[model samples]
Target chain A: MTDAIPEFKKTEATKVGITGSALTAGIGSATRKEIAIILAVAVLVIGGLEFVLWAYDVPQYILPRPSLIAAALVKEFPLLLPHLGYSMVSLLSGFTIGAVTGMVMAAIVTQYPLVEKVVTPYILVLVTTPMLALVPLLILRFGFGYTPRIIAVALAVGPMVMINAATGFRRTDSAKLALARSYGASTLQIFWKIRAPMALPMILVGLMIGSIFGLLTTVGAEMVGGGFGLGNRLTTYSSMINMPEFFAVILLLSIIGILIYVIFFLIGKKWASWET
Target chain B: MVVKLAVRNAGKRYDDLEALKGCSFDVADKTIVSIVGPSGCGKTTLLWSMSGLHSLTSGQVDLDGERITAPRPEIGLVFQEANLLPWRNLMDNILFPFEVKHQTPDMAWITHLMDRVGLTGFEKRMPRELSGGMQQRGAIVRALSLRPQVLLMDEPFGALDAFTREEMNRLVEEIWLETKTTIVFITHSIEEAIFLSDRVIVLTKRPGRVHADYPVNLPRPRSLETMAGREVFDLMNKIKADIYGMSSMRPRSAAE
Candidate 1:
């Protein structure tokens, strides 16, 4: 009887273990199938582009061959690195300043009706006026160094961030606001805890858009004024008729923009997925 | 217990339209008070004024012996809708008041409250992931987590199905029994008011004033059985008659 009891218990345990393993395997297989489909799609798209490039004798000047761009990238690493660093510094600094100031302004505008009314028209004007047009004025005022580029980037990006953040802050549910008030939440606490978290996904979107604009403005300003950065190199290359180097800088800028977008996208997925 | 809330000649107006006029009532401590009326009877406005969420156009609201100027931590409010913060998970939503007030939530109390509400093991889930009943359960947990001395609920569980609403009514009765928190719950359902309240306050249409205040002498630890009894049915009919009779006297638009 003792031996039978032990044997039966062992059999039950093994059955349960096998069932658990099967369930895990089923989930894993499903996930793997999805990933495989995505990877196959990506490879096919990239391969099709390569075939087109090979079939049509597309000139290097119009669009450098991917392999040729790769070669240029490998060859120009040292030269690109410092310029990349400079652009990154300018982008990060300007983006940080613009985002913080925009948030503060949005908070003020949201809290005070008079401030919102006063700022709305100005924001609308800024939105309508192109940032590129103001770059020359910034350069004239701040000179041809990093200052003009940073200021230009900040000016170009601030309104978008401010508008998006303010909308997010203002769009909180009245019911939740009433609930918060009923719990005796102070204005600052309501802003920080309820309004801020609720606004995060929208704010991140603003940040992403702002960063892209900041980078673009930095490069645009650099191009407009003579500088020692990648934008300046692009201007020099174009003036000297150096197509390969010009294409290389363009590739670098595209990669930077994509990187900024991907980073913020991942953050939105990880932190704000609850929004769905 | 002494009177915890007193409303004396309290009135609220929105420009030309008066919502409540000369509304007066007193609620004893450690008791549940239900305010019942038709849709536009200003029951919600009265609760909002009591919790200091809305300003009184005339007269005053007193909590204990002191006058209420603004929302105090001592008063907790629950709306008809769950209104759980979507970005926050269940536990975080419950803990929101603490985070907002810069006070550390009592974890033991939160856990106990969650257990009572049957929300255990669902703490990490977002409000959207839960069913309507579950979301309302989370909202209740959130309100109770603050341990407020006075609880003001406006049509809480009004969105629930009949069965779920009945279940929640019992759950609320149990919580009130244990906590002894002074509760003023607003509902248009006469049966709900009778089942859950120590006293039921009825109001008339726009420029609402108390039409009747009936003390429900139902026994403690009320259950589904309490709802089925003769006294409960009698009280429910009386409240219905009071509401329908008063509402019928007014013009169509004004009645609504």
Candidate 2:
């Protein structure tokens, strides 16, 4: 008699009946389909552009075809390698210094309100005025070398990182902090264990934004004064009317920017998965 | 019986507003005491003051005769929500108290507590992956991990469904028996207060004060059947009458 009612079976049926179809739509397969669509659209667009340029008989110096740009990339790869090396070195070193210092400053300022009040106005000034505008002045003092470019890159990245990181550090849930205090957790312990981990997602966002800004400033500063770098190469190629090689350097910079974005995206996905 | 905890003339004023006014109570060792009050009656404020999370504007809370001005290691608090660290797994969240204290946790005891709370299989699960009831269960276990002499729970089961809340109430009774920890449980439900406590403290609204302290003489190890008995019903009604009587006397009809 009890079994005839089928109470448990009824609940089981209702549970699957509502969400079964939607849940079965696999995320992996959906993502793969999306990637395939994107690849097909890219092929069509680039291939169409190549056909139009070829049909019109555009001169290589005036507007290189997609094929010529590809060829220039392969042919000039050996010559462009040293400049790529120089740009990456300054970019990475400056970014490392900027990001680390920004995080440290954010932690300190947030912990000490008096210090925050004193330092915030200067940070705002750095944020509003383009650090690239200071590149010529930096070059005047430090000469046309890696030193000026690195300084400009670091200055450009620092304020961006500091602002985001500071906001993240302050965004910790008050309830969690109260819980920590109830356990008699010391200030340092609370900062490191509770506050820092909670701030990581925001900190990652800052690093992503800072890295892009750092790359831009590195290129711009190199264009202003430096004799060696991809930015310097861009200036040289354009001055000599070497259009294919100029476009090739621009292509390399685009690839580097995309790589930075993808690295941070993967890091956020792996480390901050619990946020969702 | 010895006084394990005491709240002496506790009062709190938020500038012009008085939250709690001269509210006082005492809990004997190894006993369950529940406090029930009307809305805005400062039940939570009293609980927070007792936990030493904050101080009363006047008066003090003492545990084992030592005045508590700030949070101490001897008392453990279960918040209104599970309040689990989202980034941490259940096991890591439970071990947080030990991390704060710089003390090594006993894995065997932790596993045992998890078993007792029916969270034995969920140690590695993240907080977001667990159900609300499961998260609350994990919180109860975390509070018990430190082996505190007194456990102060602020509406720990308030967020759960009726069935899960009852299950948590049962778990609380069972844990109290095994560990013999003095507990101060606060709630809005009169039946819940009488069902689980040896003594139920009732507080009035606004400038909250202890209106009555009623003792329950129900037999040990109470079940759902025990709660449905005539004696339990009478006790619940008596407390309800006291609360309703106070409501009628209010000059303004402030709905709860």
Candidate 3:
């Protein structure tokens, strides 16, 4: 038994060393591999699609080739820039307002059960009512400009953020709360110090979901009423049967959606990196 | 010795379930008292009441003659499983109590405390980076940072391996000797109670009541060799028999 002690210690030391080294050393290579795989997959899919379109001699009206879409993207890039800027402004502003209010609503409701009871039904109705349906009514009230589109985006995003952030705020570890209480932490102190940090990852997840919803609502509102944005360009190009430019608008919107996901992911990585 | 901490007829009920029933005990100044009992005997509930984290349905806990209605600054608690904040590094966690009170921590004293607990170099490391024993040591250092008049620990080493638990036992003894702060420790281990405490208080299962209290006459700074001696075993047997006897009589008592 006495002899076994040193051996156990030796093994434990080695195990700790291996894991410690792995954590610091493995990250760069792991991320490199992740990027490599993504690039390889993109190459295979895009190359294969381009070849298939060319081999079948698919016409632009039927389905444009990848090369034609690429040409349209580059040639029409200057024309698309202003519309892209317009869509981005509406998407970001609405998402920011919606997400911030959602967090505030989460805090208020979690703190006061009565407020949650009174507000939750309307939130549920808003969430399930297909928010884009209100765009025409908003336009009729506010006119065919940024106001209706932004409001539609906010309505789509708000409920998702509120529900998610509330769940995160309430899901704190009971033991941690007990520790804080044992030290006589006040309700506000508990909320700020303990609950806020613990809820961060979930809150970020809510924002990510909210941003995506906001993006979709922005596009939908543009399609229904707005005379600007990539969604409007998409309708205009499709009406003229300019399929390459239509696909180009689709590509731009998809890129914006990807950018939204990447932004939230990076923020989550930086702030909510601590494992629960 | 004058009483440093006192519990008077404490009773607690969670709706219909009574966790503690008129439980009472006292610890004199600068002495360690271990509360031992069978499973579900409300040892933790009693400790929480003492810490003022939970209120008793009846009676109160007094620290230096002051009734503990809320968690007092003079008292600190070490919970089971270390309970270190995962988001904070060791140093930040140790200084949390000071942060809560809006007071600047005396860094020199905290640094000294960390050194004593063998957590000197790991101050900047997150809780996840450390082993279980290391995390518990950090927890201990955090509790001791404020120099509380009384320190309450609830099964602080219950989750550790036997070897690590024994090492922690020695660390606790060393801390108690150095600080001479009154301590109320709760555990189910009879040997642990006899090894570290001045007195062992046993409780009956469910709606816990103090079943017995045994004064340990073991000499100070007890080593593992000392714990292996005959006298320790004799006390262990005595407590064991008392617990077994209680279990045997439980059915009859329940019928009444």
Candidate 4:
């Protein structure tokens, strides 16, 4: 009895030790060295782009010289800050509203049968097609103000969140659900305990998508008619043929977009890393 | 022994497919009963029906005279896979049933069960951070922690190797002797069935019905040496011949 028992325990202990160390090693964010390498590569790309433009001396309208754009960025820095802030408010607000409504709808459908019928058809039709075409109608209704623009952002962003989150809710393991049921957990308890955590990876995916779509739609909204924003600057400077300022605004918009993706990427590593 | 769990004329149909037909059996209190049959023989269906995880198309399953319709807290089930939640560590996973039931966890009991299953120090480890055998050990101890009146195991060690399977059988035997929890284990291995069970219930192939029931009448604390005994070999051969449909090989008593 003692012979087999000790050997089994020793082998089992070693097996667990290897896997436990492997888990901590494999999970979480990039290492500090890796982060440094990424940062260095980004600097090289930006500097190389600037150097190429300087060497070429291209005409400003076709493509503003990097020096000019940077100077425009510096000159317009104070001015661009307010406009950038405006676009962010709409993007963040609209994304939040869409995400909240989408998750709420998903929760409702996963819980109740009838609510899915009411919500899914409308969300699917709107989500699958470009809702930007409907922006003109919204503009007509809401008068080119913050109302139409934010509403447009919500319409564009909400459905992906709703669809993915609902799908995620459905993807829970039947065995786990059975375990929960055998323990006499209520439907609400199962939703919170089993369904919700399992649905998180999908929900994060939805948010990542929603944030990207929100940026595009909000920019489209600003282009259509906004009092102040990077998109508004794009229209103003281009029409006036202020190439450097126009190019500078585009640069700022790209930076903000990259920042949103990085945020979600880190979040994915933190929470959903175990999925692999 | 008194009847603890009873399946009465239980039948199951999935749409057009009938998986079980008129299957009936009774498990005596505190005894280990094993069900073995050919593949796709509704052994799982019968077990699931008894667990109240699936609704039977006809007839009823009862636990201590009460009809089992839905999942009850005292009815514990061990699936073939450990099925531990990946996001939770071993401690949380073991404590999950109590958390769901809103009952305070008996920490002492959980630790004791974990020690019994040789998982005492791995409590803080995540499911993904454990080996397959370790994970299954944690799962078995979890099933035990529920302090269930009857534990229904569906091929609990089916995925393990021969050596690990033997270890698990021994672990289960020790737990049963110590706790006296009625267990209805389903398996495909005839040797395993004969070795672990007080009585073995053999079933007919798909649309399964009870084919035969034989009491082991073997002594307690049985070991691997028991499998080498002539009586055990004769029992295994008889059960195997029945399962394989070699009717000519059915055991005739030496006297007869």
Candidate 5:
């Protein structure tokens, strides 16, 4: 048994080294292959759709060809660019306000029983009631400008953020809390050090979901009311029987949504790397 | 040496269950005391009371003649589970107590403690990446970073394998000898209690009270070889008999 000890240690060390090297190489190759596959699939699917549209001779007025949408986008480049910038500003401002307000409200509600009891029912109602139905009422109250649209987006996004953040904060481990207490940590110290870091990944989850909801609400409100945004352009072009321009605006909105999701996803992965 | 801790008639009750009744003990400065009892005998409850993590229904705990109403930095606690923050690496975890108290930890002492605990090369790894024994070592280091006058450990190695548990016990004894910190370690193993302690306090079953207080006469700087002697086995059998409430069934060889 004594003679076996050093041999055992040597074998174990070798095993660990081999496994570590294999894991690093495996992850590197897997990510590269995944990216290549995604790019190839996107090209094939988009190219197939374009080919089918060409073969069928689909009318550009009804469902604009991809080429026609691209041309329309270039033709209205100057006008689309400024309006796009304006819509983005509204979306970002509304999203930020809604996310921050929701997170603070969640922290308060979870920390205080009285606050939770008072606000829980109201939150449930807000989540269930469609913000789209409230846009017209808000427009009548706040007028046909940016105020109604921004408020609509905030109202639509707030509940998701509140619910998700509250759940995350509540899921902190009791043992960690006890450890902090034993170390003579005060209430605020425990919250900021243990609870906050533990809840971060979930909080980011809430922000991503809320941002998407905010963008959708912004588009919906702009579509229903007067505006110079992409959604408004879609409505105006469709009403004027300009299908290519309408399709072009819709495509732009989809791209914006994708970009927002990608940005939040990268942030979450970077900051919350400790979370499983 | 001064008396660092005194528990006077420390009793605790939970709604309908009596956890501890009339339990009292005194720990002198720079000594190691171990509390041993069967499961559910309030060994943990007593430790928590000493740490001021739980309030007693009756009686008082005094630390260096001052009444303890809440947990303070002067007393450190290590739980059965490692309970290290998963987000923190080993060094940050060791520095947690200092961070919470808004004091800068002594880097030289921390490095020395890490070396003493056989964790010299694991300063940058996350808790999840560590083995159970390594995590417990980190927990011990974290507890000691504050330079606490008294350390309360509740089965800190109960979850580790026997080999690792023995290694940890030796390491703890070495640390205690070097630092001279008063320690109250709770465990269920009689051999463990006798091996590492200056005195062992045994508690009776539910609604626990002190059953026996045996001052271990073993030599200082104890090693694994100390546990192999006949005297150690004799004491282990004696404590075992007492714990099992089988005083009549004491081993024939142990009678001498």
Candidate 6:
């Protein structure tokens, strides 16, 4: 029994050593491998489509080849640039307004449970409403201008940000709180020093979700109302039977979505690197 | 010697369940006192009460003749878990309590504390990056960072493996000797209590009171070899009997 003690302890120490050594900056080779896989799949799909379309002499109206889409993208760049600018303005401004309000609401709710009780039902009701269905109402209330488009984006994005931020604020470790109290730390000190940094992962999660939701709503709102966004360009090109240009607009929107995710990914790596 | 902390008939009740009926003890200044009991014996209740983290239902706990109403800056606590904030690195974690009190840290003292605990070069490492033993070591130093007059440790090494647990005992003993802080050590291990403390105070089951107070007459600066001595064995037997032998035999009296 006594002889087994040394072996038992050695194994335990080794377990700790392994866990301790594994604090990699989460954006390690795993992330690199994932990005590689995504690029490889994109190349294989696009290259295969281009090859099939070239060999079979498929119609441009049916499904344009990768080369045709690339050409259309280059040719229509001048017209698409203005629409892209409009969509970006609505997306960025609405996301900023919504995400900031969500975080602020999260902080206020965390400090006062009574405020949370009053606000939560309205948030839940708004969260369940679809972004597409709200455009008609938004247009009716605010007219066919930037206000309606921006409000649509904010409505779609706000709930996700608020939920994640609240979760992050509330999930602080009780042991850390006790330790702080034992040292006679004030409530404000504990909130800023211990709780805020610990909640960074959740707050950043809110931002990522809000960004995607903003992109979707901005495009959907523009498509519904038909004025000046990538979505509006989709309507115009399709009406004119410009399939290649329409596809190019879709590709641009997809790239913008990917770029949004990439920005959040980099921010998470830099700030909440301690998580993994 | 002056009495540093006195727990006078402290009682705690949670709704109907009485965790402690009446517990009384006095710890001398600069001495190590260990409270030992069986599981569910309200050992933690008494410890929390003494540390001013929890209020007693009956009596009061005094620190240097002053009543402890709430957590004071002069008292430090070490929980079973290291409880180091995972987001913070080693240096920031240790500096936390000092920063909370708005006091500038003594760089030499902090560096020395880290060096002695074998965590000198690992200051920049996050809590998760350190081994369990190293994390606990960091927690110990964090608790002691503000130079509290009394240190209350609630089974600080309970989660550690046997080998590391002994090493922690050595580290704590060395620190206590160097800085003669009044320490209230709570644990369930008989050997651990006798090994580290100057006096071992044993408690009964729920509604816990002072069942026995045995002064360990062991030699100073004791080591692993001290466990085998006749005096240590005799004391351990008495404590074991007081805990297991009597409590189990009179089970009905315990719940009352």
Query: Which stretch of 10 consecutive residues in model 6 chain B shows the poorest summed lDDT?
Result: B246-255
Per-residue CA lDDT of model 5 for B1-84, tens digit only, reads 688999899899999999999988889899999999867889999999999988999998999999888998899899998989
Looking at model 2 chain B, which ten-residue stretch has the lowest summed lDDT?
A: B247-256
Q: Give the residue spans of candidate 1 off by over 4 A.
A: A1-31, A239-244, B99-104, B229-231, B248-256
> Candidate 1: DockQ?
0.31
Model 3 accuracy (lDDT, Cα): 0.85
Write one digit per residue (lDDT tens) for candidate 4, span B1-256.
7999999999999989889999999999999999999888899989888888899999999999999999887789998878888768899999898899888988899888988888877788777667677778888878888799899999988898888788888888889999999999999888888888999999998889999999998887888677899999899988987787823355577898
User: Once model 1 is optimally superposed onto the true structure by TM-score, how far is the C-alpha of residue B35 displaced, in angstroms?
Assistant: 1.0
- Judged by lDDT, which candidate is best? 2
Tens digit of per-residue lDDT, candidate 5, span A231-275: 788788888999878877888888987887767656654566555
lDDT of 6 by residue, A21-104 (tens): 222222333467899998999999989999999899999888899898989999999989999999999999999889988888
What lDDT score is found at residue B143 in candidate 5?
Answer: 92
Model 4 residue A17 CA deviation (Å) reads: 17
DockQ ranking of the models: 6, 3, 2, 4, 5, 1
> Per-residue error at A269 for model 4, in Å?
3.1
Model 6 spans with C-alpha error above 4 angstroms = A1-27, A30-42, A111-119, B246-256
How does each model score on lDDT?
Answer: 0.80, 0.86, 0.85, 0.83, 0.82, 0.84
Report residue B24 deviation for candidate 2 (angstroms): 1.2
Better of 1 and 5 by TM-score: 5
Residue B227 of model 6 has an lDDT of 84
Error of 6 at A100 (Å): 1.7
True A-B contacts kept by model 4 = 0.48
Native-to-model Cα distance after best TM-score fit, residue A244 in candidate 3, in Å: 1.7
Instruction: Put down candidate 1 lDDT per residue, B20-101, tens digits, no spaces.
Output: 9999999999999999888887888899899898999998899998999899888888888799987787998888888777
Model 5 is docked with a DockQ of 0.39
Q: After superposition, how far is residue A233 of candidate 1 from its true place, in Å?
A: 3.1
> What fraction of correct interface contacts does each candidate retain?
0.62, 0.63, 0.47, 0.48, 0.52, 0.53
lDDT of 3 by residue, A1-276 (tens): 112121124344433433342112222224678999989999999999989989998787988888889999999999999999999888888988899999999988987788888998998898788889998899999998899988888888888899889988878688899989888889888988899988887788789888899989988888888689977888899899999999988888899888777676666655665553
| lDDT (Cα) of model 4 | 0.83
Give chain A TM for each model in order.
Answer: 0.81, 0.87, 0.86, 0.81, 0.86, 0.84
Which candidate comes out best when scored by TM-score? Answer: 3
